[model samples]
Target: MRDNAILVVVARFLIPLVMLFGLYVQFHGEYSPGGGFQAGVLFASAWILFVFIYGLDTGLRVIPQRVIYALASLGVLLYALVGLLGVALGGRFLDFDPLLDAPKAAQQTGIILVEFGVGVTVAAVVMLIFLLFARRRADTVAAGLDPDAADDVREEQQ
Candidate 1:
């Protein structure tokens, strides 16, 4: 993978652009068509592309599995805390009216926070799933198994 100079160069150029787009989508979501989910997927896709080009071990080294797990937990906690804040402010769960002096400003703040939380959670989960599958494939190959051979054998059996 590292031997391909063109791919390496293109990836170096595109990965940052992709992440930048993800940020744009995240911040502009409330005003536009996009939101947390789209942004999160974009972010994950960028990382996945990096892994494909650089190799799984390198990807893991860049963003360890433990950090990904923590991000997932942190995102959820952030989401919950926002909702809880509404309750603490004497409103229903997720109510943004009581969040600030101005109801409109409060609503906007709440939406942004919630959306950010969703984005974080989605990105982490996607990365986690990809990492697990990639690790499994690595292990299969390490064990001297042709990963695709199982599928071919299954097809023959059927």
Candidate 2:
């Protein structure tokens, strides 16, 4: 797959479209069937597909693990901060009515922020899970370690 020029060429063109559609879904959920969760999964799938077509190193270069963890924490914090902000504005937790002069505007803004935060968190977690699983499998395969053959391996070493 890595060396397949056709696949690589198609991916280079298609991955961005997938990402754009994911973003569209992220924002369009208010009026449609998609939402942060769906968008996040779409984004994560694109990243994983990119990795599969390219390589782990390339994927890591695009988005390092440290950034992923930071964003994961940041997303939760962002969501929480939005709630706290509402409280500070003399409303209940997550009360968006006080976010702006117009209650409708406030509600929309708050909802957007909430969705963005959720999307970020989901994307980060999914990417981390995929990367970890992919890395572990690669490691086991590379090390010639089979879980079922562990006893045989130890016996041979002995």
TM-score, every prediction: 0.90, 0.89
Best-fitting candidate, measured by TM-score? 1
Which regions of candidate 1 fall more than 4 Å away from where they truly are?
147-158
Q: Which 10 consecutive positions of candidate 1 have the poorest summed lDDT? A: 147-156
| lDDT by residue for model 1 (54-147), tens | 9988988999999999989998998999999999999999999889999999999999999999999999999999998988876775675985
Candidate 2: worst-modelled 10 consecutive residues by lDDT:
147-156
lDDT of 2 by residue, 1-158 (tens): 78899999999999999999999999998789888888888998899989999899999999999999998999899899999999998999999998999988999899889888888999999999998998987687558787655656678569
C-alpha lDDT values of all predictions:
0.92, 0.90
lDDT of 1: 0.92
Error of 2 at 103 (Å): 0.5
